[model samples]
Target: MSASVDIRSVSKSFGDVHALDGVSLAIAPGETLALLGHNGAGKTTLFRILLGFIEPNSGEALIDGLKAGCRQARRLISYLPENVAFPKTLTGREVVAFYAQLKGAAASEANAALEQVGLGEAASRRCGTYSKGMRQRLGLAQAIVGNPRILLLDEPTSGLDPLSRNDFYQLIAGLAEQGTSVLLSSHGLSELEARASRVAILRQGHLVADGPLAMLQRDARLPIRIRVKTKPADAETLHREFGGRRINGASVEVTCEPDEKMAILAALHQRPGAIADIEVIPPSLDEVYRHYSRANPDKEARS
Candidate 1:
C-alpha cells in the first residue's frame, strides 16, 4: 500500500549555514507533491533529512508514523537522485537487479522494471554505452523495481527527451494511482503544474508557500490576461469601450483580477458580435512560484 510522510518543525544547519528552518509539510497516501525551490534553497537539504542522510537539529520526519532512518521506514521508501550513477561495467538489467536485491525484491522483476521504463530492449547493454537519456531511463527502472510505498524523485527528467519524459510521468501517475506517495523536486514548474496534486515552495530555507495549485493562484491574486480577437473594424471600438489596449490591429488585450474575470466576460458578451474569440490566460505555475520565492528574500545568501 501507500505511505504518509510528515515533516514537522524540521530545522537543520551546517555550522552557520542554515539549510532548513522549521519547515513543516506532509504528503498523504497516493498524493503527488511538488517541492519547488532554487539552488541552495534547502530543497536538497529537506530531501536529505527525509532520507535520513542527515539529522535535523530539531523536530522529526516520519514515514508511516515511524521515525525516518529506522529500518522499517527506510524499507518503505525509494529515491531517485538528481544525478544517477551506475557501475559502468554492469548491464542495465544487472543494475536494476542489483537495486531490486537491495530492496528485497525478486531478481526476476528486473526485466519487468526495465520494460516499464522502455529499457527492456537495451537491458543487456552495458551502462557505459548508454546515452544520457537512456541512463535516466535506467535510473527510473531501478527506482521503481521494488514497488516502494514512498517515492522521491529529484530532477527526474533532467536528461530525458520529450517522449521519455511523457513516459516517465505516465509511470509516476500509475504508481500514485496504486497508493504511492510521491515527492517530486524539479525546476520544471510547467511540467509539475499539471502533475502535482499540491505544491510547496521554499525560500531561503523557509516554507514560503504550500497549497493546491488553484488555491495558490487565488492567493497570489495575479491578473488574468484575456485576449479578445475581433474583426479589424471592431478592434478599436472594443479597445476604447473596454479600456484595454489594442494589439496586432485585430485583438484587444485586457487584464483583470481573478474575481473580476466573469464580470469582464459578461460585459464583453453583452456586445454581441463585437468579439469573435476570447483566450483567457491565468497566472502560470512559474509566476506563482516566483511570487512566493521572492516574497521574503533575506540579505544573507541561502546556502
Candidate 2:
C-alpha cells in the first residue's frame, strides 16, 4: 500500500548542528508509528517538517502525494504539540470552534468533537479552570476538528492520569480504525508497546531502526527467558536437563533463542510434574532501545 505519510531522504541542518540526517520513513493508513529516541534525537524536528512548520534542507515531506505545507496538505494533516498552550479565558467550546473556523469546518461541529473527546460536560467551562487532562482533551478536540486523514501527536498523553490516558488512547485507536495515519512521539514505552503498530528508533540525527515491534525484537537478538516452577525434588534434574540455573527451591530459569522456545517447552513436558508453572519473558521496548544504542555507539560519537 502507498504511504499516507512519507518522508523521503529528508535532512535538516542548523549552522554546525544537524537536526535530521538523511531521515526517511513512512506511515501506512490506519497504522500508528511510534517515534522513539532520547532527547535531541530529531523526533520533534521530523514532526515539524512533516507538519509543514519548517522545511527540510533536502528531499521531501509528503502527505498523500501533496507536498508538505501545500494547501491540500493543510486540509489533510492535524498536529498537537507537546505543550498545548491556549487562550486561558476561552471556554473549551470557544477554543475548538475557533480552530474549526480556521480549518473551514462548521463551528456547530465543535461540540460534537468535544463530546468525542469526553469533554461534553465541560464544553462551556473556561480553559483556565480545566485540569491538565481536560486541557489535553481540548487540544485533541481542536486537532480533529476538520476530520484530517493524518494525525501528528507529540507527547499527547502528558499530564493525563492512568484513566485519562486510557481514554485518550481509545480515542486514537478509533481514529486509526477510520484510516487515519498516526505518528505519535512519546516517552511512554509501555503505553506505546501496547498501542503502536510499528516503531522507529532514532539515535542522534540518524534513523537506526524502524519496523514492527516483533521484527525489531528479533533483530535485536536478545535471549528469551523462561522460568519454570517444578516439584522441589526434581529441581536438580530440571536444571541439568534444560541447562538452566536454579533460582529457588522449586524454580529453574533457562534462556533460549526465539526459535528454540517451543522446542524447549516440548522437552520439558515429557516428564510429569517436570514443570508446574512457567513464564516466558520477551524482549521489552527498553531492552530494544539499549540493544540498538549499543550497536550504534559509533554513529553517536561521530554525530
Candidate 3:
C-alpha cells in the first residue's frame, strides 16, 4: 500500500538563513510529484525534512498522517540522495545485502534487488570500481529493497544514459501502479512533463506553484503557440484571415486558451486545401519558471 505525505506550514532555518519558509503541500498515495526550482532553491532542504535528516524549525512533516522522523514513518519510506556514497571496501552485493538485513529482509533478497536495477552482473564488484552511473543504479537498488510505500528521489536520472533513464522511469511508473507514492526533485523540466502527475515549483524557500501540471500551466498564464501548415499564399491568406502572425512563411504563432485550440483547427478546416497541418505548442515548464521568477525577483533572490 502507498502512503501520502503531508507538509503543513513547515519552516526550516540555518542560523540567519531560511532554507524553507512556510512550505505546505500534500502528495496523495500512488502519485508522483515533481519538485522544480533553480539552483539554491529549497528542494534539497525539503527532501531532507521528509527523510528525517533534519528537523523542521516549525510546523509538521507527516507521512500517512504520522509525524515524520518516527520509527513508523521511517519504515514506510526510502530515500535516494543526489550523491550516493558506499563503503569502498564493500562489494556492491555486500552493500545491498547489508541494507536488506537492516530492513529485516533475508540477505538472499539482495540479488533480486540488484537484478531489478540491472546490476546483477556487477554485484560482486567493489564499490570503488563502479562508474558513476553504475553506482547510481546500486543506490537505487538499495532504496527499492523492501518495496517501501513512499520513495523520495533527488535528481534520480542524474548520471544515467538515455536508455537507462527511460528504463528507470518505466520502473517508477510500475511502482506507482503498485501503489508506491514517489516524490522526485528534478531540474529537467521536459522529462517531468511526462513522468509527473503534478509538480510543485519552489523559488528561494517558498513554493510559488503547486498543482497538477495542466493546472499549474493554466494558472501560470502560459502562452500557447499555434501553427498552421499550408502553401505560402494560402498560409498568408489564412494568417490574414485569422490575424495570425507568421513565424515563417508556412507557420503561424498565436497565444490562446487550450479550449480554443479546436476552434483554430476548425477555422483552417473550413477552407478546403487551405491548411495541411495544425499544431498547438504549450509552454514548457522552464518558460513558466522564468515567468514567475522574473515577476518576483526579490523573493526568488533570497536563496
Top-lDDT structure, candidate number: 1
Give each prediction's root-mean-square deviation over alpha carbons. 3.5, 3.3, 3.8
How big is the RMSD of model 3? 3.8
**1-303 per-residue lDDT for model 3 (tens digits):** 333999999999999888889999888888999898777789999988987889999988999988887889888898888987999889999999998888778888989989989999999999899998899999998988877889999888888888888888888888988888999988756656467888888877888777787776677776677877776768777777887588768876666776787787676678867777777778887777676545574643342
Candidate 1 segments whose C-alpha is farther than 4 A from its true place: 1-3, 272-276, 296-303
- Judging by TM-score, tell me the better candidate of 2 and 3: 2
lDDT of each: 0.86, 0.86, 0.83
User: Which ten-residue region of model 1 has the weakest summed lDDT?
Assistant: 294-303
Per-residue lDDT of 1-303 in model 2, one digit per residue for the tens? 889999999999878889889989989999999888777888899989987889999999999989988888988889999896899999999999999999899998899999999999999989999988899989999998889899999888878888888888888899999999999887636656467888888777888888888887777788899989998788898888888788977999999888999998888778766678888988787877777755665643343
TM-score winner, 1 or 3: 1
Reference-based lDDT, residue 26, model 2: 88
List model 1 lDDT by residue over 1-303, tens digit each. 324999999999999998899899989999999888888889889888888999999999999999988889889999889886799999999999999999999998999999999988999999999999999889888888999999988888878877888888889999999999999888747767377888888876888778887887778787899999997789988988887788899999999998899999999888877788999998887887777777645521231
What ordering of candidates by TM-score runs from best to worst?
1, 2, 3
